[model samples]
Target: MTALSEYERLEAIGLWRADPQAQRRDVILSLGDASLVISDAKAGSALAHWSLPAMIRCNPGERPAIYAPSDEPGETVELDDEVMIAAIEKVHTIIESHRPHPGRLRSFLIGGVVLCVGAVALFWLPGALVDHAARITPQAKRVEIGRKLLTELSKMAGQPCTSPSGDQALAALSKRLPGHDTIVVLPEALMGARLLPGKLAVIGRNAIEGPDTPEVVAGYLIATEDAAAGQSPLKRMLGDLGPSAALRLLTTGNLPDSGITTYAEQLLRQEPTPPPTDGLLRAFRSAGVSSTPFAYALDPTGETVLGLIEADPFKGQPSPRPVLADAQWVALQDICTGR
Candidate 1:
């Protein structure tokens, strides 16, 4: 149920009733991750969440179509927004298309033994399904999922640091980098830099504060991107959450909040593995930044990361230009300090 890009976060006005006998009330209907959210128009408080898969159009092909969740017969909502109705119908059709057809059952059963053998070779059925889901998942859905993870992680990591000057400096720094990701500096709890989906990266306070040159932080960002080349952060998250989470996302276009919270808790304690040396050096070369600073940052003695030092792309020479201006660097360093 990966929703269409145009319909992401779509909303419309509607009338809702808690039950058959209840009076209809004005509500705002919003397209949630995999459900329709009914909220009080005046108070803006969420009243109910109706699963899209279970949604039933009671008066199909009629104006101000009446709808209800199959699970809750008495509750109903009335919506006349043609765009919203079309979006929901499209999602429902996609879900239905994925379901097994009774007519194909015989053919499916005929290949059951072969499928079982292939599944045994793969060692897990969900792995294939998860991979397929990850491949087909659109950018919009990835951003939505990443935003949800960040919301959960913020509870443990603390709110992201922001200030007028610092935010502008961060924006400039992103433009200087290769990926131009939305870089967030957290007050505390993150170690180095971690890249999330949707071209977002989060770094610990030290990345900006400890480095004398912005190249150091830029190197960390580049390294994180290269690290994700092997396995995307989104796919890694789904795999960690287990098969059911992936299945839910494919069928319902949403991951269970309980699973997300649990995964966020685990992510807080886990350390990021360093990117490969060759790949990291290549990334540095591509970004026109020297790796010496980052290598020394990892090991001050430079004994362990000697290759990064000697193979520095800009060794014995200045970078093509400064990674950041003197003033911008100062602003970024004090981002958490609110200076």
Candidate 2:
């Protein structure tokens, strides 16, 4: 309070009593910005700081005024300094003039708090809840969700090709591939490959049946994994499912069947775009596979996919290991034939 600056350094002598039964002692009373400071006269050590506004004159309209803190009436101060008394009264007047109405301020603060809460519920809760749910979901649960999504996707993509030998061959390929544990071959409605939740990858039948070398199909699988960049597929699915379904899944541990069907339809409509060239090359290097075959498969002339061809990790060098055995490759090619 700028008005208080005039009396800020003002001091007075007063008699102070700690409580009703204590002896009155000489004290130095000093004016503070918003308080009255009391100190021991002999030691000059602080005794108390009383709020200027809460100072009450116990006996008003008399000489040698007796005053006490509003909260503690037993503790009192006896002062005869007219200048200090007048300064304190002036400060009280200034404070009262600047004070807002208690009722109005309380109402305003309550309303602001309520609006903040409502905003959080409307805008922030859904995305945060979805993120939390995605982080905590177990691997087993993710696999279950992926299977359920595959069931819906199968309606459009066609059921996965399953022959005794083909299934075993696919399992071997899955083991050979890094990042994902399962590789599902569909007869149609898939171009290159798609990585799903729970380290599952879905590929078209042509990837195996049409290619001469297993490296081509392996490259496609690696490309899909690179495209995903280690993101949780369940999080992507939940994003498409929206907040309501995400909340339901969080509470019930299951997504809505209708939501899953809708997401599958959306997934089928979207084409899988290739990951960045640099990242694809890195994935190829890490997998110890050549990118030449996959590059050629994307563009037979090798014109459009020249970067991948030129940066092939196995260029002018033999691969560290074969992606699959000759027998496994042959069996995988016959997967759709059910032979």
Candidate 3:
């Protein structure tokens, strides 16, 4: 907001410039009437009406005067000069405050946050609610909803995992995944490796199915298991379930039957869990296997697993023979699918 320039003259009574956007705004000044009125351009709205003579009254100790909304039209108000000046200054201050300014948006943001905090504080927002929510959240709920929504994918179709060669292949792969507590193999049709809440690796026979070597299969399992364990299967499980279900699980040590079934299908299908790249790399480093094969198994896309292929630690190392030989791999390959 700006004041009227000294050189600029307004023909309309006492209208004055408020800013660069507008040279002058409508105003009225009446000297003889002992009162002044400020109105809209069309005089359609009365913004302020003040009495002058009484406003200049001085009866020794004078105090500033104030006005409230009027009940009737053309209501008259009386004030001392000091009071008038104070009132005018206050109005000016208010207008200045209302003027557009840079970074004033902080007031609005602060107000909004204050209101939200007030609402939350007004109500009994449970301190432990967040923790309970984590506990009671269901595992299946961790997965998105709907059919084949990753969480509910139970069955897989495809040829079973063929014995890569024999028990030797299994033994070699087992060596790769030696740290894991349990190894469960499904048919290749099952699609990918799924690590369950326990130290269980759900893999399709196809992981050992095609042209891939036993050590490659072992690399995949070891990586998946390490990823799962690094995150703690139970922690990951609780994280997915959501706060409510997580809270319930923490309290009851169990989830709903539907919750169990919902995720069970996902386990059955072996839809892979995305392994943390860093974790996988670290695990591969620990297992002494090239991550290239597992990376290829996960994403053949050159873009996704290129790094692994390039930096295979076990690139030329002589891998140990598997407990399940190449022949055994063939037998285990289609066990699930043939059924």
On lDDT, the candidate that comes out on top is 2
Tens digit per residue, CA lDDT, model 3, 1-339: 122233122112334333334455545432223234555556557656554322322222444333222333323233334433443444445556767876668888888999999878555343344445544455453322222222333343432233334334444455556654445565434655665543445566567566355556666677667656556454555455544555565576556656656555545644446566677767777766667666666676857876666766666343443334555555555444434
State the lDDT of candidate 1 residue by residue for 73-131, as single tens digits.
68899999999999989988998898879878877886897889887757767787778
Q: Which runs in model 1 stand beyond 4 Å of their true positions?
A: 1-118, 121-124
lDDT per residue (tens digit) for residues 269-313 in model 2: 885678999999999999988899888888889999999989888
Model 2: lowest-lDDT 10 consecutive positions: 1-10
Distance from true location, Cα of 190 in model 3, Å: 2.8
Q: Rank the candidates by lDDT, best first.
A: 2, 1, 3
Report how far residue 83 has shifted in candidate 1, in Å: 90
The candidate scoring highest on TM-score is: 2
Question: Global lDDT of each model?
Answer: 0.84, 0.85, 0.50
- Per-candidate Cα RMSD to the true structure, in Å, reads 28.9, 11.3, 12.6
Clashes of 1: 0
Ten residues in sequence with the least summed lDDT for candidate 3: 1-10
> In model 1, how large is the Cα lDDT of residue 104?
87
